[model samples]
Target: MSGFWGVARAIIGREFLRFVHQRERFLAALVRPMVWLVIFAAGFRAALGLSIIPPYQNYITYETYIVPGLCAMVLLFNGMQSSLSLVYDREMGSMRLLLTSSFPRWWLLFCRLLGSTAISILQVYTFLALAALFGIVLPLPGYVAVLPGLFLGGLMLGALGLVLSSFVKQLENFAGVMNFVIFPMFFLSSALYPLWKMAESSPLLRDICAFNPFTHVVELIRFLLYLQINWGALIWVLGSTVVLCTIAVWGYDPARGLMKRKS
Candidate 1:
């Protein structure tokens, strides 16, 4: 038990130290969503009208409506960036050393995921604070209430990134792959517009968005931020996390998976 905790602490600490040194990474994470909130939302405030939605008691501004989604965006991008670092570590041979440790590979990976999720949550709260400064405050209790949702959402997305890291062999190729996964997931979800809006445009497209895991992620956070629970979203996010984590574990399996080929 001591050994297990020790390993977990070391891995999580390393991730934190790495993030602290990478000041630009922190800034970049905040800037992308801030751009959407400050500039894009402002432009679209008049263009896209929102009705009083479930999590919202009254009509809200475009900036307020998108805050949760942008928070999810921070997690999504950070997850992919964490994966990118994994690929880089693999090339540098550090990941090989870590995997070869006495600890179970899954345990090591979970620690990595946990660490990434922590960094992501920190970035998220910072974004939320900045949003508050911009006059997009949520209920005070909602800030405390949203932690569990953020943790779950972060783990799910981080697991997805772990699965991707196992397959990506080189650092240079990750950018294109990130784009392939990131853009569609972001644009097609309820991040920018509600499902009803999408349904109004095209029911087929709306169905596609409904099926998207990212959509549920956004919904889970959105509801939690308003001190509500979207039970369906919670189930979807939890189930997706398990599935993705299983796939990631298999992908990194030495004897039976991609790691075997790499070895």
Candidate 2:
């Protein structure tokens, strides 16, 4: 048992070390959300107007309203960024070495997910801290409570990334996929605005956002931060996680997926 844990620790440690070596990656992670929260939300404040929303009572600034969404945004981007690195690693041969390790592939992939999710959690905390500095803090317990939600959400998104990595041929082609998948997933979802807002804009858009797994993820975090349990979100996220991870395993199968490409 100790040996098993030790191996897991080693894998996680290597991932953390690699992350620290690429400090610029952390900076890039912070930049996008900051732009949305600080500049974009700031500009949209007047245009967006105010309505009392769930998990919020009375009036609130547009920046405060979108804080949870932006937190999810950081994780969303980081999850995909980690996947892009995986494709790069596979091309560069590092992934082949990792895959050939004595541990089961699922275990190795789980360890990779753990490492990426840890980094995502750290970025979320940093974002919340910066938000606090700007007067958008949640309760201390709320921060603690939201950890599990973040973990689940991070895992779900990271697993999706893993599934994508198995299919992506090269790092260069990731840009087009991200443009089509990530942006639409994030925007169409209830991440920035509530589903009702989308309904007002267009019921079709609202329905799409309602079905988006990312929307449930953001809703889960938002509710958890307010000390509420969003059961629907929890169930949807758990279901999606199971589905994506299964697909990822199949996609990484030796006789198919990326294995055939290398052979």
Stretches of candidate 2 exceeding 4 Å from the true structure: none
| Alpha carbon deviation, residue 22, candidate 1 (Å) | 0.5
lDDT of 2 by residue, 44-116 (tens): 8888766888887768788877888888888889889889989889989999898998878888888898889
For model 2 the local lDDT of residue 169 reads: 88
State the local distance difference test value for candidate 2: 0.88
Candidate 1: where are CA atoms >4 Å away?
none
Error of 2 at 184 (Å): 0.5
Across 126-212, the per-residue lDDT of candidate 1 in tens digits comes to 999999999989999999999999999999999999999998877889999999999999999999999999999999999999999
Each candidate's clash count = 0, 0
Local distance difference test, per candidate? 0.94, 0.88
Best by TM-score: 1
